[model samples]
Target chain A: MTNLTAQTRHHLVTARVENKAGVLLRVAGLFSRRGYNIISLAVAPTDDPAFSRISIVVDVESNLLQQVIDQLDKLINVVAITELDPEEATQAELLLATLARSVEHDADLGVLIQSAGASIVEMTDQATTIQLVAEPTVLDDFEEKLRSYGISELQRTGAVALPRLVQL
Target chain B: MKLTGAQALIKSLEREGVEVLFGLPGGAILPVYDPIIDSSIRHILVRHEQGAGHAAEGYAQVTGRPGVAMVTSGPGATNIVTALADAYMDSVPIVVITGQVATTSIGTDAFQEVDTTGITASVTKHNWLITDANDISRIVAEAFHVATTGRPGPVLIDFPKDVANATIDYEEPGELELPGYRVASAPDERSVAAAVELIAAAERPVLYVGGGVIKADAAKELAHFVGLTGIPVTTTLMARGAYPDAEALHLGMPGMHGAFAAVTAIQRCDLLISFGARFDDRVTGRVEDFAKGAKVIHVDIDRAEIGKVRRPEVGIVADCRLAISALNEQIAKNSAAQSRDRIATWVERCLDWKQRFPFTYEGAGTAAPGDIGRIKPQFVVEELRRLTPPETILVAGVGQHQMWAAQHWGFVDPRSWVNSGGLGTMGFAVPAAIGAKVGCPSKMVWAVDGDGCFQMTAQELVTASSERIPVKIAILNNAYLGMVRQWQHMFYEQRYSEVYLSPDLPDYVKWAEAMGCVGLRVTDPKDVAAAIEQANAVNDRPVVVDFRTDSMEHVFPMVPAGASNDEILVHPSQADQPR
Candidate 1:
């Protein structure tokens, strides 16, 4: 039997769309209709307010990536798209993990926190919150460690990426 | 000077050179209808909104203009949905204007309220909801542009009641600017060169023509290209008349129920030059194995259709006219075009297939001199084809009869045949034939319908009779959806599965008489010609001929739906007989 850990690839796609109210819905609706799961989606104002840039990370079967692009290209609101391959793009995710204060107080937790590349953002007698800013893999590892400490709250902002440049 | 949005809509249509429109007036659309009463554009009031939409399609198909339909919202809008989807599926250019509830009542679901745009979003080529009076001219212009351009499909513009009632100072619409929808340019030199290179090298090559050639108005270019290349061609169902059926180079339609020679040639060609045709499921059965031996060259106006099915060795994105013209020029320059004697054996085989499997009905040839009763559907279609002129427009209601009509009729020129090909819409013939006659008022129009299909939207004949549109209707009354029954017989253990319809129920003759049309029921085979001639003689009103045909007849040379082209089912009893 195949392992339950699903084998999928994350694709980072950036699109320029009209800043109208229904634009986002139409785009997301397309993703759902085509059966592509959006791992994370972020939209922000670009240089021109008339249009905004939407960054989406989707986990899909590798063979179906071109079909997704083709489908997206047909949507009228989408003006342009640039797909940054995982290896060619610089990527990062910001994740906040809140854990019980008992873990921080017990077993030299300060060294573990420093070594794990997590910074404390807030602390109280009962709870402790730490922020991790790093590559997606590093963030995933930190979240896995926080879950064992009986975490009270956990928030992960999906990956945001830009194409990495090599000097000419 | 300011004009209300309704007046502006009519004025804009007039400016676009629209001579007529087909529709019905209802509560939500009364404001627009008021302006239309005095406008030069003639409104052909149809019995149903679906009829109106189909009539518009018929007009567009024959005249090569964007057919226009108008209707009220809610039920009126929903009724016309089939026409929009039909036009969409067939890639026929039509613009539909519909009334919506007042702007304030849109979300509140007031009287005759429906989200017309939302319902039609997927089916339409493009759609717009009018919010301001000033937006009419631009939106109308855009709708026409989008409807007629590219692959050419239906466009709908939803006119809210309040917006139509509002007034604005209208100026002439400016230049067309479509940011997202761009008209395709001619294919680059390399792709055209590559296509020609394949054509010259292959010993067995066939030009697979389709409706896109007719849609592009490229029949002349296609003829010129084929003439210069000296290559044999096959037209699809939607492209019945795109090429002259009388020509020796013609291989007839190629698909399910298509010519044996044409389907076999597609299966065996060394190089398949697919000009302006999508390899639809019907055409390419067992998609993985279609055109097993051919190096395909797909040229279309739509880029998405290129790799959407079978990936071609060389794909060219350009208008059919430009692409074929370019290929012809390249063939003229290159020494690659093969000589006539080079592929003589293959051509001979195709000619043999054509002769061996000519579309025929049982007892059609050896009938006794004065034989009467139990008319064969193919026989009726052939009789109609022989009676009609070269320039006559033939439309069909979808069923076994539609297939038979396409197979038997010798369509001599482009834009001479119109049917619901992609959508296979039942009850398409009468209204569409009305639209065709309206578009070309001087030409003879004939609607070939099936009994099962005719019952769906036969009310449109009333519209034709009232409008004084004299067209001929030949209902092959087999008393069943013959195609469906044929399938049940072939594959489903002959269950017959609710496919039969009783003849006395509708009484087509009485139905026609009630609609103010002269109805002729022919039970005898010998009287078929005389009945058709009598129908032809009448020019003041429409005529319906209820031809009581053989109930067991089936469209042959069948691909059996999901089966491969090689697995065609020939006529059962005549399997061993020579053509």
Candidate 2:
């Protein structure tokens, strides 16, 4: 059987858009209308209040990368688009997980959390909440390991990336 | 000066050189309509909002200016969505101003209120919803600028009721702050040189032209480029009038119902040079197999369109005129001695194909005097072509009559042919013809419509009559949705389902007369010319000539849906052979 997943590559594109109502929808609408698969999307205000930055990760072939960029550039609200190389760019994501807390597995959970570089943010008699900020791949591993403790709730901020600064 | 947002909208349009607009007013748009009476811009009140949108498109198509349309929120805004989509698909520059509910009541589901901006986001090239009265002038200016520039397309501006009623001190907007938007007009010399090299070395080359040529006003440049290169040109449906049909190099339109020579030329060419035309599915049937032997050279202003379909060997992102001019200069400078002798054999072969498989119907121009039942649609188109002047503008609605008009009308002038090429919107003829006549008052405009299509928006003729637009209408009455019926006849075991729109519903002649138009009916084949002449003579009012045509007749040289261009069905005899 052929694996459909093997044929596709993940692409990260960061775009600066006008900070205006309906602008985000305009950008998202282009992807949806064209039927481009958006794997993850993260949006927030930029340093300049007049503009917002949207980081989108899409599953597409290499041939369609330029088309994606070109289409995004066509939108009036989209100010600029930059494709960040996953290998060279600095990428990060945040994961928040609420897990059941019991005396029997408390020591094991504590050791697991410390080893995975995750910090317990809240503690209750019934449950414990942990937060982790790391590369998406690392968070995926940590989240998988946390599932053994019975994760009640989990939330993830999709990856945000920026090009690494070059040494002078 | 202190002015309401509505007043500023009118003043801004005047500043943008808008002389005419088409619209119908409703609740939310009342304030904007009030300013129209005092404005210098003449507004044509249409029966429906859809009619208003199409009329604007027709105006823009002929005048090479941004056409304007206005409507209220909710149903009114939704009604014009088809026209907006049509303009977007065809890249016709138009500005649509739709009124919305008061900003306070935007999300409350207020009366005559809908998310106009949200609904039109995908359809428009760009749109804006004004929250402040101070931003009206700048937004209006920006709307026009965005609509007309680069790859021209439709733009919509949604005006909330409260904003339109609010008064503010008007200040002329400063320089446009579209930092992201830029039009690349300068031709890249390296790409131009490469294209020229391809032309020189190519054994058989065909210039696949599209509507962008006319949109770019590059018809003259295109003519010069083809003449210099000695390349045969096959214009697309949207680009019918971009190249003169009488020119020796013109191979006619290439698409589903294209001429045999045009279809075959694209299929057979060793190199395909696309100028301002996207390789649309209608043009390149079964794209994988389309022009398998050809190396593509695509030049369009929109970079997104370059490799979106078939990847071009040499893709140049620049205006068609600038690119063509650059190519012409480089070719002239590089090879002054190279004559038409290089590609002479290939040209002769194409011309031979054109001569052998001419776009002709049986009994064309020579129908017997009393042969009333045998009148063909192609014959009527030919009669109109024969009777009208070369410069007369021809507009068509969707379906068989559209294909026939595209095939028969030897359009020699750019901007002389208008139709919904990409979207194939029916009932585009009457309103578009009215718009075309309004834009080009001195030029003759004739709308060639089909029976099924004519019934869709025939009420627009009333606007044409009341406004004294004086456009002519030729309804090819085939009594059925002819194109669909033809497909059913050929493909679906001859089971005609739901395609038969009755022959004599709402008697088109009486419908025309009721709209204050001179109605002429031609059942006899011999009266075709006289009827057309009579329609042409009525310059004071609109004229509708109902030409009863053969319902069984099919548009020939058709590339069946999703089939390769190589397997085109040229005639009925070829239809029997299994694919």
TM-score top scorer: 2
TM-score of 2: 0.97
Fnat, 2 decimals, each candidate: 0.16, 0.74
**Candidate 2 chain B: minimum summed lDDT over ten consecutive residues — where?**
B570-579
lDDT of 1 by residue, B1-579 (tens): 699989999999998889999999898888999989899999999999999999999999999999999999999999999999999889999999999989988899799998888777667877788888887898899889889888899999999989989989988888754556666768789999888888878888888998999988889988987777778899999999989998998989999998887998889899898988999898988887788989999998887778777878999988988888888888877665746665778788778888777776676665442363578888888889888787989999998999999999999988999999888899999899999999999999999999988888888889988899998899999888899999999899999999889766788899999999999999888898999999999999999999988898888889977788888777776578553
**Each prediction's whole-model lDDT (CA):** 0.86, 0.89
Model 1 misplaced regions, further than 4 Å: A1-10, A21-45, A56-64, A90-168, B175-177, B366-373, B573-579
State in Å the error of residue B444, model 2: 1.0
Off by over 4 Å in 2: A1-8, A102-104, B336-339, B365-373, B573-579
